[model samples]
Target: MSTILFHEIVFGPIHSRRLGVSLGMNLLPYDGKLCSFDCIYCECGFNKDFRTKTKLPDRENVRAALEDKLLSLRREGITPDVITFAGNGEPTMHPEFKGIIDDTIELRNRYFPDAKISVLTNGMHLNKPEVFEALQKIENPIVKLDSALDKTVRLLDRPNAPGYSVAKQVERYKRFKGDFILQTMFVRGRFEGKEIDNTTEEEISAWLELVRALNPREVMIYTIDRETPAKELEKVPVGDLQKIAARVEGLGIQTNVAG
Candidate 1:
């Protein structure tokens, strides 16, 4: 068994593959790990055993903590490259998500006005008026799309019910047109007894077609990098990821392999 990563409100001016050196806001909990999906490759492990009491931090508390972190950075003369909304779960799940984004954007303007703010959303609420509207204020609102087919998506994402299908997600992306970024986590694994091998030709073809249809500003391609609940899983190698990226690039879509 692996040791658990503690839940917390903020964690790192740490380097990120997608976003540079980022300061994270963990709205979840110091012990909570909730998510819209129970992905096998999640860095925080499955949300089951770590489900939080949903004792979300009040807006004022969140602002205070974020400000403290920013002020500390300023005092030390250390400036992060990005202020990110990410933690143990899907960020959009927060009840005050819009307000949080507004507050974060405002703070970004104050402390590190030069820094960019980002949200790592699952896109489950991409169609929700509230969620979509909030994302518009950010400099980079990266959304995930691990598969193009409904079944594969269901297995890979394991989203909470009431969230709709791949078609609905594509429709949501249409609203963003070419502004939104698409991030697909590639790998082979089994979840809840279902085999999730999206690296296969059939699955990749379907995914590439979706990319062509969606026409996002860019596509981020990467695989598992941390310990997950599903220990039986195997990580896809860098060369394999490059191969997949090449295929997507052939469609004339911009691709980043998280290198």
Candidate 2:
């Protein structure tokens, strides 16, 4: 066992390859995990057998902790680029997600006036009015769309719900218009004996079409950075990743390849 490593409701001014030096707010339990997607490559480990009770800190506590951390870092003359909503699992799963984001925004403005607030979500709750409103307020609303194909997405993400469809995700994404950032993990791996790979030509083509339709502000292409739970997964080479990025850029959408 990896000891299920979350220290508190607020953890990390950790290095984020995409978001820069960021502060993380984990709305999920410090010990338990709750997410709609049991992603095979989740750094937090697969969504466990725990009940769906979300151990989210209250909105005021999130603000106070984040403000305190920001002020402390300011006293030390340290600057952070982004204040992010992320953690052991899908952040939108928190019942008071909208309130948390609102509190985080107010605190960010009070402390690190220049720092951007970001939310990394699985797009599970995008259709909800409150979730959408909160997301719209954040500076970086990065949503995950690992694959456009229904079956491929379910396999890679291991969605917990009965009717988790990629089309529904795409529909939900439509509400964001051009405000959202898109992230996709390109890899080949097997889960529960299902052959899964999103890096195939057909897969990429389908995904690109969706990207074009979404017209996202940014498209992030990243393969695994650390050891994933699955062993047989193959990393998409940087060159290949760049090749995909170029295609996205050609569509006039900003694209970043994780180096």
Top model number, lDDT: 2
After superposition, which runs of candidate 2 have C-alpha atoms over 4 Å from their true positions? 1-4, 49-54
Residue 53 displacement in candidate 2 (angstroms): 6.9
Q: Tens-digit lDDT track for model 1 on 1-259?
A: 4635545576788898887889988877767687888777787777787776768777788888898899999999999999888887888888888888888889889999999988888888776788899888788878889988888877777777655588888888888867877899988877667687889999899988889998888889988877777776778888989999898788888888963
- Per TM-score, the best of the predicted structures is 2
Total backbone clashes of model 1? 1
Clashing pairs in 1: 7-30
lDDT of 2 by residue, 82-180 (tens): 988887788897888888888887877887889998888899888789999999988899999999898887778888889889888899998888888
TM-score, cand. 2 vs. native: 0.94
lDDT of prediction 1: 0.82
Q: Where is the poorest 10-residue window by lDDT in model 1?
A: 1-10
